[model samples]
Target: MKKLLLSLVLLISFLGNSQILDPVKWKTKVVQKSDTEFELVMDATIDDEWHMYSQFTPDGGALPSVFEYKNTKGNYTLVGKTKESPYKKVFNDIFEVDEYYFAKTAQFKQVIKVTNPKLKEVKVYVEYQACKEQCIQQDKTFTFKLPEIKATEKGEEVIKEEPKEEIVPTEIASNDIDSTSIKTEKVTETKATTETNKTEVSNEPVEEEKKGLWSIFVLAFLGGFAALLTPCVFPMIPMTVSFFTKQSKTKAIGIRNAIIYGFSIIVIYLLLGILVSLIFGADALNALSTNVWFNIIFFVLLIVFAASFLGAFEIMLPNKWANKVDSQADRGGLLGIFFMALALAIVSFSCTGPIVGTLLVQAAAGGSQIGPIVGMFGFSLAIALPFALFAAFPGWMNSLPKSGGWLNTVKVSLGFLELALAFKFLSNADLVLQAHWLEREVFLAIWIVIFGAWAVYLFGKITLPHDSPLSHISVGRLFLALLVSIFTVYLIPGLWGAPLKLISGFPPPMTYSESPNGVGYKNQGIVGATATLPEHAHFSEHGIVAFHDYDKGLAYAKEVGKPVLLDFTGYACVNCRKMEQNVWSKPEILPLLKDEFVLISLYVDAKEELPKEEQYVSPETGKEIVTVGNKWSDFQITRYKNNAQPYYIILDDNGKDLTEQVGYTPDVEEYQAWLDKGLKAFKK
Candidate 1:
């Protein structure tokens, strides 16, 4: 009898741990509005607390609902894009975009024109994601028979409808009708279907194209300042101004000509910006920021630039091009001034080319149509300012310091900075690909070594190919050396696991580290206070006692009589790391996360393949689930209708919500309050 009772208890536990929750229901129907025109409606009856995303979610947001007509060649033509019922629009913090979703119920409709009289039925394959406490991917194929129409005496088609009392399997409320019934209602465009009648318009202004102009200009201006410190451009300042002072007929003419030269420089760079924009288009350039191949290319390009800056070799324009442009400058007029500007550009190419390339790449990544133009404008303004100002005040030339080895120091320092920055692009690629080779500790170590070498070089302990022999380190050099040495020391603690909040975005996240559990630097504020747990307690990658599987988490929560804190997260989520480091590390919040609630961190992007027996076809999306990520991603969508990471929900052991769902809230006090509220609700 005792053995039987123990076996029964074990069986119940296994069943509870194996339960998988799916929370969405769908129905489809075809409604005849006119004889030739019929509306195909897809209705979703979502479970309570769950929601469905609309088909119009913006780019960089959650996947939108989609409907694909399977067999439309013979009998029907798709009239317009899918139209959806009213949905709630809210700003999603995780993706930093406005997203639309529907709770409880959602209806999508597509108008179809019957092309052949012999048409019998219409078939549609629908795909959507639903979310509440979790998400699930769902797909369904719906078939609806076309209603028969009879020809009258005059050959006009009339509806042969059933009686109103007859029960229809797929009937919708009359008041819940499609807005397409109104003549003025516009159909919402859907990416899933194409409309043949829609006219393509060009030269239209777009919102994304207008963004980041000012930011690009500022960054370009800073790039120009850095260029001004380079060897090729610095010596030219006094020489060019002196020529205007000595060669011109009068001071006024020299000033005027110098201003014209400045304008010419702006025009030249602006034309270059325009050419680049024309070549690639703003959308494609913006997308390059996230493209792995583009990032790898950028990494290699930057490394080459760093090598050049370190005096490995000079990256120069063809001498023939400069000579040709210089020859044009001998004409001696406005055209000559423009050609002179071109000559300056060609001559300074070795020094400024890399800076210009970096600036343009960064600006283009911002996804603004005017980014290149604004960046060029700012860069030109900086290069042009010295020429215009010094030409106006010829006497100021005496105040300038003579150029020497210090300029080389500037170049070498920039090389170090470039080398450091180059790794960031590499790290971005590594993180996106889930290649843990450049983990946080490894990245920090590399940075420390690079900066330490740079500090030694600053103090004249080391020298590059172009560096002059140092008699002694100057006071300024000493100060810079000290600063770099201190910075290198600061980064050392990060290897053992320090938050290093100052350079948080540069390195791979702390969670993606060799010691993610804070093994060595336990005293660091980021390390969570260890808690005693039952022998069966499972922990996350970060060493926090948490469950990676949902059913196991809920079962544990039930056993412990504690509420579950469902953390919908991703491995690559940046804000999620910020929250963990800044807010969750706080005294007020850490205890609750560690002790008060049962933390269940579901990594939506986990790529580990599930066991073959554990994998199954997703009912919602009709895709084979082969990995742990797919299962959790599907769960989040099906339960909560949200696809963004860092989503949090507090639920009782019964899997009911104890508090409202929150996402990526970084404020410590607010998060603590939220946790306290959930705890109170749990107790009640």
Candidate 2:
């Protein structure tokens, strides 16, 4: 099952490698004014569907065109700032900013006066980002030479330089630079790097994001089906269908009304998703996954929901709201059918509300703004289908099992699962804060109790609220008891430091444990010979020694004559943990991770505070950087342009990339091939 999910993740990543978009073409013309003066003219012709932002575009998300003239102070003097053609001002919905951009054609001019007599050429580069359905970063380099001035015996006579033009093959930017500005003075020169060789829209990240939404949809759909079997909804299916059949003039009208009712139910849930998206917004969604406070709140919220599900007390909407919606259902028309759907939602809040709330939280944590909407659509569809189908074919109504003790049994079982899931959020917070409150063994112990007790309950050993008195376990109940027992047994070894691949993403990582090795034994993955530990290093699970500090890891790799494998991971990153448990622990890959590379695991979400002297303000975002995680996160965005976790990069002795960096690779063969490629490059 773990392998299957990883394969799904990889498949989505490959599909996400969409064609790269290059919507703007750049051409540079150097107009020679005299021996010392030149006007660098740059023209951009944009594609019909796309637009390029000007340098003055405000900070939001869009990239603006920027020009950098290298080594300028002693060599040349700027006559004025770079001038750009008038552009269109438009509002961008996604970033919510007033973007200044140009369509069709645009021109920019920079006038420079040469000061150095011996200087022959000056290099200039311009990088501009253009967007249509998606955005792409592109850049081009140009050089201007000093015009000739020949001296006669008595006086100086000038033979002027001719105007020269340089066309496209302009390099594009892969890394991020906050805001837009034309530099008169040189800051730091970066390597001209491209993210991919593909010359179309490289929106593979977008598709990978969709993969997460797809998973949420599937989970939510399953949740909806579970909601249908609960006490609040299952009986309503029969009674609601019966009302439609008896009240309508004909069977056709009855079926139509029922369909409308289901659609209205769908709309109601969709609106709830929309409301969630609006409240959180896109930027906040990114932080929801790893934020300590949010995780703690979610932990508390799920605990309350679990307690409600366990028959301690009921969770319900206000009685007045349901009463009002129920009254509207009696109006007898399309409006009445819609109100009937609204009433169902209000009435079934106790059972379905927790499930809906959980789904939304999970979806929002995916960092995709549209995730909740997609999840709610799937959830509502699963619920809505039954009402419409049953009304259309009234004869099928006899097939459903009679609502009884089994419904409450389902609810109680969910309560147990919820109790276990609640700890996962707490664990997320613990991992991020590195609080050491919930380590590996303690987490497994909690699950052991939760699942073990649930198994006992299934076998008729205990009773809870709404449970009918039982003499013996039913066949189905007995089967579920056996499965839960097997799973509970499976968790026992986890206390002694098992990977627990089956529940990889739920628990704390193997690194955050009472013992990095097993409970009493050291891992055998290390020390074919005795290996001395490096500074800032610790033994992770599988006895693979790793460094938490980047400089230490890289320095150790240099001393050991090995390549550096930079793992930009996160403590609360679900997929990051999944890769560690399932992919990194594999027999074929474990040796490579252990032996070939000096592994540096930089936790981007680590919440440890940096020292006061080390802390400084970021020039780009102007935010005060106070923590180690925030510093590394900035390093990643500034150096790589990508910001997703479980990001991997292989480097030689120096810090340059050996190959293109990759995000969240799960396939063993594919990942091994990438490792091999890096090894081969390092050898060269």
Candidate 3:
């Protein structure tokens, strides 16, 4: 029966892949810049299983899709970069992504700055890659010279390119003594634009990030739940309540002690939260976010957490130290009982340490003013719950399960999970700086091997020194082991060039693979072609070079007339996805892309260099513009003065503001209005 079920599942999987193959479709649009200059916008849609590369790949990686104007007499200026709409899919252990496109269409745009406005003919050449299991590289050339149109007397078609020249040069001098003069002018102009644009537009006001009493209550609720499972708290619930019942010689007195015990746990945990807040100060969390060493240290700490779970060693405070507190319970007062609880926490740290570590890490990462307090609330609630419940109903203790080897198993499993979670942070570090080694596939390979070994260990095929002997396994255990083994097998296809669609962009893009090109198709067919080719897409021949630096991209943008599209995104920003899907899809919006804009996506979470010359200290806040993203972020914060995303703006040829900046427009109508405002501003 099991074999039959497996076969049925495999068949369904094959059918899903057979459909949704990448579809190659293309479209174009024309935007008039002047009587002599017109922009050509062509969009290409490749089938589901393929992707085109950017212009800059490191050594041994896929070539950046190349473009050359062909069959043209007009002077054409290359734009900064091509823009792609974002895609989404679940990320998994395979470390690869399936590049999806708009069903049957993709778009590309080119701006032509003609030396002679009267010229009627021009040509374009493009080279790119498209693939399934095998990639077919292709090159195509097309001539798209404009057809003549007679002028209308009423100025209906008397299109005069306003030649609204912008001072956007390929470079800006940071210390151009006139920079101060420019700054004053820039600020005044920005304020005038904002005032003119404000007409009290009607839209639903977004709820601000929640604050006040309810937020605190919610944090407390979550903390209490986490504490319930701690070894120190669960077992002691019945013991403490039973002792109170017997010694006090009355149910009421016992109930009173139990209530007091729960309150003591809360107080102690809250104090810890308070102390952390005092020591770190409110701004420490924000500072840590950008501090590279903190991230590295976190990575190492999680590794230690994983090892401890694997039974490398018990992590606990000294017994004498804990015993000193435990001994205070004999003093017959509320403070003594509270000390006893603290002693229990210290002594049982070996068992409870992972949970505490995880909570603290989460708190630190959240970096909210009340983060520690919220975290402590969750911990104390979990610890306090059982005491209240057991005291209220003494008979329920009979139903509680006794501690056994399964408890140890739970600890080890969590350790494995922590180890896995650690890599995500590492991956974040790698991708932020565009480190190529931690490609999606490589990350997956490590995870698959680790989890596979864990499965084997779970089944007793591999045993830790401290593990309990397994005389025999239950059917349930065998079934779980089988499930994990099958999942591991699923990752193997990725090494041989599978997208592993389950975990798409969450992993590093497959463009980072050792040999991402068609394994057999290398060196034998038309580049970016429809023709079949040899398929051994070897690693040495094809690798993906990661580029995370914005300054570098900006330099490339200037080197190449591509307008820059700034995408201020976060690793955890859900709204970023909403903007990508909801707004970037309209037909009018997609086509106007090339004539007026160069797309530059700046992920706020990315880590990379800021050119030393470009870096500076912000006068307003005195913060260093440390990374490439930081420079852009500083610009966004100081100029627009808003950090919340998804923000959009358009700049002219001189990299000066050509439009009003818009932030977080979720409504389609509002988005269109916002975009239109920018377009008009650019035109003016």
Candidate 4:
């Protein structure tokens, strides 16, 4: 079972990066409180596993949602403050404060008295912070068209129902939200989370997508073959094949039952795959990678499985359930064979369940429904094939290796690997949270210790709780021990940043270490790399001198007679991290960025508050620019005409562009070339 999980992780490490998440939607409606009084109703629809902070956060750790009213000045007089729906509160570990937020939906209301009856509509946008694995502050626009209202001097007249103020619902994109662009209808009726707002999943099969799914299928098939080598399932092949031959009256009937039995196992696993999709919602498998709870839960679950496999205790299905399943195999005919397959599934769950779960995780990471289905289909096919083939020819059972002490050796080895695989999840959570608990050096050290101990155990120096007495180690065991020892030695260099490309994804990125250069590395005042730092300039995580404020960085660039690397990034932006790890760390690019450019990294999601005197309302959005992030974010929108993170633009000493801006360039050579071009132009 532990081996199953180990192989599953090995295969899944090849899966691609995570998807971009836009988790909140917004809409609004206008309500006539009386003839001249109107109320604006705005609601936000949040996606699963994500929550948005309330307008008035009680403890004030997270950025609270704020609203901006546009084009409603002289025509209407302000009523009371905006009232929010009831929200839930929870303590945040990062900020050490309780935060108020809403899951699924959050509603807010604002009432206004129309001094001039000509007020026809209302426009507002909400800026809020939403968090799941990482926090993101984004905006959504809501345009509410007002209905025609008539007021008479005689008395407060009851509004006529014939021409009610109903609004045709519409979704406004963040960048495209303005007064003149959005098309809206004036009716009182309003709707939210409607069909227009639903994010559609394309079931259309692309060639590359199918190829990726097929790769998962093939890898899962190989994993299935590996699972058959485990003690739990390997010994059962002979027992089950013999039972089929004895029960059937004729040889052909036995073969038929065996084939049917094999398919039943496949069906069982396919159901597991389908369950993964259904449980996570229709097709949320794609978005599961960045989920914080999922990583934490998986880490703990795999550790428990590893402990069980290490002979600490047996993790087993309920005895009563197993007994009932075994009893069903006693029934005669086709039903009995199907039950026999079920019996095997129940009995060997300790072995197969972990592998199946690991495979599903791998498939789910692929972000395709077909990957899970086909991957499981391939996995169960591997498990079932040997049973059917051996039943058809009982003589083949003699060729199978007899289960022995070697099986225990394999199990213990896998338990060690299970420990290794478990940390990958924990590391993922740590990276997501920037908790710094398991940096690259710490992680590599842990793996070296784990693999080293396993090698020592394989040499017969240490016997586990279940190991049989052995006078001497087998040649096979000695050879594997040597291999493990060499692999352990190979990992030692990774502590000092050897890239360790062989085990890349298993550990955190090279930059996410104790020393950005390497373990125990220090700058001996390298001329271009290290110098007297200017104001607001500090060594960034990438080991390059960086400034958070744009003006300071630009001034320094002018003084140094170098260009500027304007990085509009966010702390939680996954793409930005990817670029830093894969592109900036390149031998060709890192030095150029360090020496040739004064790098300014303006974090669009930074949580620190700006100076009180510097804060004001944004002229464009009318939202308050309170935080450092808010200032940088508005600056990016106004200056660069872009709000997306991981945005890079090379500028001359005057802070003018030297090259075209790019976002998320994955190709290292292309990015390096871009930097080279920018440098050449600056020099010219």
lDDT of 4 by residue, 1-684 (tens): 954764454234212112233677666655566778876767677888787886644221556788888776787766866866545545443232335667776777788887766666677767777765444568766665665767433222122222223423344445325322123323322333222222221222234455667888998998788678777788899899879888888988888888898988888888887787777642355344445677788788778767766768766789889799778889867787888888888888777666676677767755565678888999999999998899888989889878888777776776787788888778877866778899888988999999999999999999888788989998989999999999999999988768776775567766566886676554533445555667788877557789988999999988989999999887645456667777887888888887888999999877799889999988766667889998987887676655656777889989888877766677887677677878988999
TM-score of each: 0.66, 0.57, 0.48, 0.66
The list of candidate 4 runs beyond 4 A from truth reads 1-140, 144-219, 272-277, 283-288, 360-375, 524-531, 540-543, 554-598, 605-607, 620-623, 636-684
Residue 405 in model 4: shift from native, Å? 1.0
Query: Distance (Å) between predicted and true CA of 338, model 3?
Result: 1.1
Cα RMSD, model 1:
10.8
lDDT of 3 by residue, 117-179 (tens): 455555555655443333223344444545343322221112222223522222221211100
Residue 246 error for model 3, in Å?
2.5
Better of 3 and 4 by lDDT: 4
Off by over 4 Å in 1: 1-212, 517-537, 541-543, 551-684
RMSD of each: 10.8, 15.4, 21.2, 13.0
**Comparing 2 and 3 by lDDT, which wins?**
2
Residue 73's lDDT within candidate 1 is 82
Candidate 1 lDDT by residue in tens digits, 113-219: 88887776677766666655334444556666565644323312222344455434443322112111111111232221213111111222323233346657887
Clashes of each: 24, 9, 50, 6
Q: Cα lDDT of all candidates, in order?
A: 0.71, 0.73, 0.53, 0.72
Q: Of models 2 and 4, which has the larger lDDT?
A: 2
Q: Any runs in candidate 2 off by more than 4 Å, and if so which?
A: 1-180, 183-202, 523-684
